[model samples]
Target: SVVTEMTGLGAHTLRGYERAGLLQPARTAGGMRLYSPRDVAIVRRAAALAAEGINVTGIRRILQLEAEVALIRAEFDGVPQPVVAASAERGASGTG
Candidate 1:
């Protein structure tokens, strides 16, 4: 509900986002979609992008890249030294 309220976008539209891979909200056993705070934030960003005239395809790519960057930042921020070395070795050897 917060998502719908925040975006002024309907449930069907949100579900469309899910179908198009822009959002990945949790789902109930009975298959009802559940929105998290993170999901809401992503949807808000998506809404902003759409309003800026980016189509869903561009929005999806942007969101994907954003997620990847966040993951890379998280990995770098809290990494212990050995894990970094191992990751580097894996990269060089192409064995990972």
Candidate 2:
């Protein structure tokens, strides 16, 4: 697959990542796994983390946390800076 070729990971390793709940590639009607761009990015990141000696469990957690942070940032994207600063100040002062 292009993903395996691009990431330098084997099909077996990709299946292992799916089994480990680290990836959720889409499937075709015939049940072939389809790796989207996001899936490919995740595979690359997971391979890098593994090369850094992080286990699957740690990789999953880090990915989840990074996703959460991205979500939070997206949610804040359109808000005014003053509003964000005020909200932060209120939370800091325990008055939010």
Candidate 3:
């Protein structure tokens, strides 16, 4: 998981993700940050954006949209042409 991969980050960094409205990883019965693949991807993307001059707030919004777009793209890809067009229109209308 990303938490295990990121061995040096302290508690504050974990808290920061939560504060930014990022995924709150499911806790174990004993209380641990059980990150999902999606959560890890978000962290990696946030890091990449930060490296490219995006501030935390901007990164947060971008990450949110990236996840949404990914899901919509996945659904669109699974559907037929008419459905795909409808999905694209929904996205264009900012309703997706």
Best by TM-score: 2
Model 3 lDDT on a 0 to 1 scale: 0.76
lDDT by residue for model 1 (1-96), tens = 667887899988898889998878888999878898888888889989999999999999999899999999997989998998999999999997
Per-residue CA lDDT of candidate 2, range 9-62, in tens?
Answer: 999999999999988998999999999898899999999999999999999999
Better of 2 and 3 by TM-score: 2
Q: Give candidate 1's error at residue 67 in angstroms.
A: 1.1
CA displacement after TM-score superposition, residue 20 of candidate 3 (Å): 1.3
RMSD of each: 5.3, 1.9, 5.7
What TM-score, to 2 decimals, does candidate 2 have? 0.86
Global lDDT scores for all candidate models: 0.89, 0.94, 0.76
Q: Give the 10-residue window scoring lowest on summed lDDT in candidate 1.
A: 1-10
